[model samples]
Target chain A: MNEREVIETLKMIQEEKLDIRTITMGISLRDCADESAKKSCGRIRDKIRRVAGRLAAVGDEIEESYGVPIINRRIAVTPISLVAESSRTDDYLPFALALEDAARDADVNFIGGFSALVHKGMTGGDRKLIDSIPRALAGTDRVCASVNVATTRAGINMDAVSLMGKTIREIAEATKDRGSVGCARLVVFANAPEDNPFMAGAFHGVGEAEAVINVGISGPGVIKSALEKIRGSDLETVAETIKRTSFKITRVGQLVAREAARRLGVPFGIVDVSLAPTPAVGDSVAFILEEMGLESCGAPGSTAALMLLNDAVKKGGLMASSFVGGLSGAFIPVSEDLGMIEAASRGSLSIEKLEAMTAVCSVGLDMIAIPGDTTADTIAAIIADEAAIGVANNKTTAVRVIPVVGRKAGDVVEFGGLLGRAPVIPVSRFASSDFIGRGGRIPAPLQSYRN
Target chain B: MKAIITVVGKDKVGIIAAVSAELAGCGVNILDISQTIMQDNFTMMMSVDLSGSSVSLKELKARLNGIGERMGLVINMYNEELFNSMHRV
Candidate 1:
């Protein structure tokens, strides 16, 4: 590489905070199914241990060799609802425990796929998994649960949606001592992607290969810094800058994903070009939007700016990698993003604005903390609204809100580490219980007839 | 295989000599070298061929990190592919 190129690349890492957010190994647990939940858990643990034995160590080795940080080494297995379906257990807590133990043994921070897809309808296993979410999440530390309540193809499952609302409340109450952290581990999705490498949403779909390596690339800081250099540029120029920066960032992800897959003898999946932000000052996606001339993240032109940002990221990333999947857009998780946290704390950002942003960006109301008194129906309503947006737009969207039990609005709860801290944002005081009480599918939109 | 070794720290004597000695000790051949001093801060970049190195990249990195610690410098060694993949296409 040329001297200027080398210097720029080094600057992107050393100063701009460009890094691989996650390298998720998707392991199919279909073969682990057993009639006994005990036997099933054992098989699950052994399979993960055997497949992901070198995951953390290899991640460390890659970080050292490449001089780029791989922030999370995670695993996504086949949805537990599917894997544990044959097991004759009413409670799936053992399955979650097995995932947690295997993740601990493999040295991965989180294991996803404690999930059920009920967009169409719920099976007995799906019902049991959904019911077990509160206890399962409360019982385990590293296991994440996700439920798909709506899809463009299958429409919205209001019954599952209503159930999830109550489930989220139970999860919050069960983990009340820990600031309702269990809710943070639970994601409610609409049109959720199978190959997503991001947390609270990742799952190995039945359509996927037995094993694959997926990477999530992050660098809102780099894009923001790039835009900072071209201050006062036109909109087209701004879009071009973001696209070029995203291309470069995703190239690193592709390289790491390929290397990890080769070393682990797994097929390389896709590189998710998601501009996932951390709580660090410079890594916020909201800062990138603000840098695009917004007064704040929730300003009038915020959605327009985010649309430009998200589209450009995808356009650039599509060219850099052979395949691109997952929620490959800018994530606006409130607490995990310093800029969003500040905006929310200052009252410039609201849940309504965040919901609007999700229509254009990646994910839904994420990492947000709400008042403890917020009812289950209200949380479910929030999920339904976010799901409607995803279904109508035919994109991936998810909610990972934490209702800090016993905390009121404006109170701050610290989750520490990568989960970060969040200020309890106010929710609508008006009741949504009557609407949520009517349980049936929100019929598929006309757009679903495209095929 | 090739890698880039970057050193950044306060300017001091024998920084290059120390870094080069460590690389040579591991049988890593230096392909190119660039050095500059900016505002009393020493910054050096080297392109080294590690195909003939006796140690693995991880071991070489650990050794270089140890040397950097002892010399009070911020030393980083990265595979050349990181730059190529990012900057090329």
Candidate 2:
């Protein structure tokens, strides 16, 4: 063992906040489906508890033994819509509640997959699951929900997009007392990944194995700390530093992922090396972009900075881990990042700039708060625009904006914890109801037609 | 079967003697040891073979943590594979 490298690794953990963000166990709930809703919910709960009973314990073991904090233990199940659709029910809230109960039993903080993949169209169950999202999220504390209204292969479903806008509004209204925090747990996505270990968007795709363990490695602080050492260096050196740092970070993720999978007797899945930021000042991806000579994260050169970062992160992480998937780039959740919060609050970071950054960064329009009076059509339009970007680029995009009820622009809303605090930023005043009212599918872009 | 133990804190007499005594009592054989004073603080690194030890890794950590808290030092024992995985690979 090299003492110098040991000291460096320990220093990275002790001061630089290098840590495994999440260890997510993806369990297929396909076998839990039944014609009866009650039976289906019961089976779902039982299977989750049985398969994931040791998940949190194993995560704790890995954390303690490796000296890396595994911050979250999560479970992403097969989308409830696929299972609940076979059940004779219009309401899928019971399925969400079952997930909530199972996660609590297993001592997991968050359980994702109260979701529907309706990029092409919505079936009866998909519509039911989407309809029940507001109620499920408002009622459960740990259950997360996602709706994929667009994909590179399927294009955008304007009807689903329109419905999601209304659904988000309903969630805002239902959880109004909690600063509309329920909306924070709901993510609307374009080209959503099947094995994402991150919350509000993770789900086990149908083609995935019966059970798998996917890990998300987060180290914005680690990368920033590395960049600080090479100050005054050129962009080429900065990119190289990021790539090298990312490789080391992803190796930690691979170690934890393989250990967790071994202990849980589940097949190992991908390691999502997303520079997932939190509310902590030291752990901000925005600060990394700022560290690369930008005045602030959302400055004029920010998109280029983020593009270099995203590409380098993917390149570095691809070789370190056996499997690399999910939104494997830098995440810019405005509310969840301290530097981004500072920039957005100072008016340097705008929604328009974020949309551009999304084209280069990992996901799109994430955790942004807009005006309360923003219409559903306008929200739908925003989703449509973001979806267009994802489909055209053949990448994933998502919108998890909270239109805080009765709050206008320039107000702050605290959702607390990892969801963080968001500032209510302004959007365009121009209306797009006509375009949204024409509720039909936006055809798949030329880029998506690749065979 | 192998582990790396890192101890960092203020320099003190009998630090090595106390740590080695604990390892000897637990039947853990120290393969190599390195000690240095970086700046003003004392730092020690140990590569140990734990295959013959009677204690589990979790229990060994608890014991070391007790010693650390009393000595005003930070002590950590991790599976050696962790170092090889991150720093080597």
Candidate 3:
């Protein structure tokens, strides 16, 4: 701890906006299953409440003692579909309600895992859970829902993809009074990670320990500021600079994750080395891309720039932590990033370009607001396209588009707080109903044949 | 445990005196101190040993922040582990 290092760290915190984005305790609920939904929900709630009781207080203590801001304290439970499968009742709304109750009791921000994994095909419980998503998300405030519709190994489940498209539309319609904010809490995934700490995509997988603590690091501002100092440098130098910055940022996350896990007496899960952005000025992933010499985000060469940035971040972060999992790359959620929002509003960025960018970055078209008239088929097509990228590349990608009800293109949807606001970006008018209607498994690609 | 205390604000009289007095009152030993003035703003950084201090680290931080507020300065206290973990491998 030399003087220069101390000053540099302080600067990163004060000026560069480095902070731990979340400390998510992943609690497995497999043992809580029961034949009766009532008893099952009761056991689920008790398990979450007991496991994550000290999460928020511990997060606060760490933040205060270390002088690093921990933005969120959340919990991720095992996919409810698996846990509630033994229950006879078809409705899974009670499961979502129980999750919300436990989240409230534990005093966490969001609780994930109201989810079903039907990448290959759907089970009876998975179908019921998928059917109840719209109602579940609409009714519960803290519960987030996700469905893994594609995987590199299992291929894409077109039936489930189509179902999710319709589910999202139903969710939007059910919560239209709140500007369809419920849809924001639902994520459709391809190759979803088991230990992700970010939401609405995080869920505890079956293979994980009974309980674990995972951390997500955020510092788009720090990386952007670091690149700002190396302006006019070559592409290689730019990548190197980003790598160094990510290394420093991820080390802090590793520290916090270890300390939190120790205090909570939970096994430490992987550190998600993602540069998650906020709507605040200077705290944006798009700004990092633009600082790399793009005229604006979504411009030509934006994907190339993002690819370099993402690869470098992972390269640097891998050395900082021994166990790095989750979506360890850059996130380009439009509404959560001021630069992307400005670009979208001005037409400098479009949904098409965003789709292309997702081919290279971590997540797919995220936090984007589409026109109210956008059809379920089109959203499903969008998800399919992003899934193709993830499946082909063997990486994780997710879609969390909110189609603001009654708002057409050129309108703005205000979802204030960390969710931020989004300008309604127009979707393709050309229909994809015929393609989505032809629902069957898009068989695993050639790349998936390596085994 | 070691902690670094940094103070930054417009240059003024008795800034060091008041800060050191507060630390000494809490039985915190200052191992190293550095001060600089750039463009009429004063900046000070100190390496202090808190293991011998009677007050908890949180209390010392709060006390130092209070002193900083009264002196129209900004003070930050961070555990040295934060720097070591970030900078050293």
In terms of DockQ, the best-performing candidate is 3
The deviation in Å at residue B28 for candidate 1 is: 1.6
Residues A3-64 of candidate 1 have per-residue lDDT tens digits of: 67888988899999999999999999999999999999999999999999998888998887
Task: List residue ranges in candidate 1 displaced over 4 A.
Answer: A448-451, B8-16, B35-43, B62-74
TM-score for candidate 1: 0.96
- Each model's lDDT comes to 0.92, 0.91, 0.93
Residue range A1-451, candidate 2, lDDT tens digits: 7789888888888899999999999999999999999999999999999999999999888887788999999999999999999999888889999999999999998999998999999899998999899999999999999999998788899999999989999998998898888888889999999999998899998999999999999999999999999999999998899999899999999999999999999999999989999999799999999898888778899999999999999888988999999778999999999999999999899999999999998988999989988888899899999998999888999999998988899999998889899889999999999889999998887763466
Q: Which is better, 1 or 3, measured by lDDT?
A: 3
Off by over 4 Å in 3: A448-451, B11-13
Q: Higher lDDT: candidate 2 or 3?
A: 3
The TM-score that candidate 3 achieves is 0.97
TM-score of chain A of 3: 0.98
